[model samples]
Target: IVQTYVENTRLIWYRHFCNCTLINGKFIFGYYRLIPSYGLELIVEILLNTRLISISSTRSNTIRKRLHICQPFINKHHFEYREIIDIKTNESIYQLNLVVVSSNKDTTLIRLIENFEREVLKYPNRHQCFTLTILYFYQKNQTINQIYDLIHQLSIKYTSIIRLSIINQNQINYNRGLGRQLASKLFSNKQLLFFLDVDLIFTGQALDNIRQLMIHQLSISSCTVYFPIIFSYFSSMFNVNNRTVIDINSNIGSFSIYGYGNVVVRKQDLDKTGGWEINNHEWGNEDVNLFQRFSESSSECNVFRTVEPGLKHYYHKKMCNGIVNRERQKICYDADGVLLGSQRNMIIIPYGMSSISTIDCSSFEPYDKPISTWKTLVTNLNAAERDYVKSYLGQSLVEQCEEIEGEIDSLLDIWRDYRNETVANCTNPTIHSLAEPPVLRQRLTTEIEFFVKHI
Candidate 1:
């Protein structure tokens, strides 16, 4: 009986199932109907001869106004217009999968989720094909029932357009990078993955801008990643009169080149870069590490930065108590061997390093020193002591310490010569500008060559 039912269903599908295609400005439709012996009936229908309208051909504002005006008509007679509209023609264009990592901060998480929902509803077109996945770390501070109730309420509220999925981490950790890495694996089917911090407050206009940028990047076959030039407004920048509004205009030019507050990239690009560094936890250079890996993956992969204004970041207190301030200046170059930026005044401490107590003291703070000094200290420490430090400092810090030490030693001679030349030319420099001089290109090239050979 089961074989007979399967054969009948296959025959029906073979006869009637067809992909809707546009030919000569008209769509070809498919329709199917099946009746079984058990009084089960099924029907599939597709609107015929639909006119394909390219979203790019018309301004979004005009389309929005038209949609608003025809909303009532659309509801009254949905069938008449169903066959004439195709907002998105490319079936595999892009689908945005938003990943949010949350923890015991229930109130803040709730507020952020609510704000996102409100913004999404205001600009429905921006999130037309979007899904929200929340990775909640189970914290002892909040009861499990409370979390379930909050998730249930949210699911009911945004049931129309947004598909919401909640993932609960059985064990809680301070490492946000690890949580994001795990959450990313859940959305393997989605083309674009957007990682957003829960503290960020996004406006409707900003979301629309992001949507347009992602769509444009996806449309370009060569462009594999899209990074937005994020403008940050600290907690102090919030309007005193209205806490909800942020004054982002005041700090217009002070934008970070590699802002990770909200990162949007194709899943393939992320996969190529091995995704976020799972070993990173608390506050570290996880974003910078991922960016570097992405650049190294492919020269053909284009990274475009959107400078449009729409998103604002809110500052919060640090979760860890570490005072290891590493102030060494390192010239970091991009994938094209161009000087992108310099790393300086970095606070390098392992996640949860300060939380553990030593046997001799109630608390311990790792002494901040140069990479070379740290390497010497590590070498001099006993086996048991080194193991203890390793356990507390985590793998990321241990590897970084070793790498920095090697890099510094390898580049010491070249750096000394370059410095001497720079000092001699300082008195009678040809260029007085703040920008890097063309004469220094040789020095930078040498540094890059050294890195390629050793790194």
Candidate 2:
């Protein structure tokens, strides 16, 4: 039956490695199906073109060592167990099979069987050594049990080749930010970071394409490219001249090829200019800032995009009418409050304006540092530029001091009476209820408008 199935799916079997050519004629026919869906077509295509580099005994230790270096950024499931074949059978199997066997008697078995067949037909050729990592942000309200369930499910589906990790802002030990932080830690040792977004599912030859571009003549040292995720959206957004290469030497420009997320960096050069700043608050424009910093430091930081190999698509929902500014201010205030109250001897700037007129901290406090130190740090600026910022902060400080004094007085009064306790009540439920209706309508309207506007 196995041989017959392999024969029926000749395209997939042809690409599978090993010395199975001689044993092919010794098997029998298996039950069959007549029609297949688009999902099945994708599975077959992905299988025929994708490459998986097997973990050899000699190279396994090297990979394991690299994983250990990322230990600070990784969670418990970041290094997980992969199922090997039984000693007697000597045939390796996926955990998905065990799942199917256990639930064989269920009514949904047929659907499972079809999906399993499709999956089995996918990824027949293996060229690159790939490991899956799942990242989740640690939230105060999130339950550990729920996190464990999510990890377990992904582990089983990906055949225990998956690793799980969490990033928590409160933990000083781990830098809890976004992709750049994760990439900096993970790729410290690796020559290339290849910081792919979480939603990108490897279909086929993605790594191979990376290698080719690196060796290509037009490719520069610090070039990053992307394969398309969604067709029409990508084409319209990129203004596709087809297989066109964009030069982003000026800014950290992004590219959408074949329709997907951008491939962020060429790790070696990115590290030299400095990895992501651990100081940036909850994600908004951090990528742009990083790109600007890189461009200012190095001439090689360029972006070149290309088409996706097998037309893979990914989608993620975005925020809608959510109070992003309010949340950012809350985080900044909390961070400042904690820093001021902590025993750490470092000079804590409870409130300070950014060098570029952006808000760095929640409030502006006068710096007690030496004039010489401030002058040195604010290099590349004229004497007048320095004086202007200092003068502005001095005036702002007086206003902030008055507000703080009022707040202190108010708190003292609240301690005397219980009325202020009402202000501490939870606001999440109300915020969520208010966010839902408009958010749904807005998303639908935006998607439709995007189509209408483009077409």
Candidate 3:
């Protein structure tokens, strides 16, 4: 029995148009050049198993429509191993060909290891061909001993997927992270590239979940943000005076959800752009970083979103490591500034009741509804309105205002005294000036960059 193995047993691709290498060394649009032309028949043959196998990383309408048009021809041929593979390894030890998805950019080894465990080892797929291989950012750390051990363990049970070099981290740039990963994934025998996040739990239906996210054009997409926990906390401590809001305008085309900690991109678009943005290293902002980059750079970055129903985010535990609670005051001031800028009506409409919540009720219900009875009763100026309301005199507004004014005044004075004490403890000449009185530093920094220039 003679068995033949084709180089591309699976075809992972994105939804958008891409340029492919032609026989004569020229480049042309892959979808446009191939779909309506003679390549359609060839694709049909691959689909039906005449002489090739067709597997895509996406389930877009473009791919679906094209596949449907060639359905009759595809149905004619029957190949033995033509399938869309969602890999999951369950037998503990299995040798498999692994494709490390990365770019010469921002993917740190720590981030890559997290991605590997979440996207690869966490899943249970035994369909891969290579004996044992690992995909990741191999530069962030010097320890390959642990990876070697994992591979050694896996090689004992399965003989298909085998170990290879750890993948490179993506090079930071504008929008080429996905493209780089695609190029790397294309070289492997298996047409699967696990695009894992630095912070994600790779449990339960990991492969299937990734496949669903791949439908929206890109290889994979994480769930939308719904549980407003992050936003709510930020608002309460940082922007207490302002309504907690998530900007929908920021995500024009890409569906913006609030809670997804990460996603797994497929291999198709990875080939075109190279990999994730290496330029963006700022924490709290990598999600939009790659998505925005790919949307602009690759004409073929068809990515999608998947919901990790019960997924856990382990990386978020470190959020409080270097943060300062005092910094939250800045957020409060900024939010108040926006509310003041928008006029007083920008206040949130009271939901259940007005007294218990900070929400203002002037914008809705009786106030807006002129014909409503509640409106008439409240605004109606009868004998009660005519009566001089000065009947209930208490502390004067000036006195009350003066009390608030004194409290704030005393608070600032105490801050000044404490600040002076802090200045004495700091011996470092470099940071000695930072201990200056808050008001004094504020005034000096505004007038000149003398301190900044020195530090």
Off by over 4 Å in 3: 1-144, 162-164, 167-190, 212-261, 279-287, 294-303, 316-455
Worst 10 residues of 2 by lDDT: 61-70
Clash totals for all models, in order? 0, 16, 67
Ten-residue stretch with the least lDDT total in model 3: 21-30
Per-residue C-alpha lDDT of model 2 across residues 29-56, encoded as one tens digit per residue: 1112223331111111011112234554
Give per-residue CA lDDT, model 1, range 91-139, as digits (tens): 4345566778877677777777777777765555655566577777775
- lDDT tens readout by residue for model 3, 97-204: 233333332334334444444555444452332222444444554455665565556555444444444444434222234323433443433244443333333333
- Give the number of the best model, judged by TM-score: 1
In angstroms, the error of model 3 at 224 is 17
All candidates' lDDT scores? 0.50, 0.34, 0.33
TM-score of each: 0.47, 0.33, 0.32
Runs of candidate 2 with Cα error greater than 4 angstroms are 1-128, 144-161, 169-179, 215-261, 293-297, 309-317, 320-455
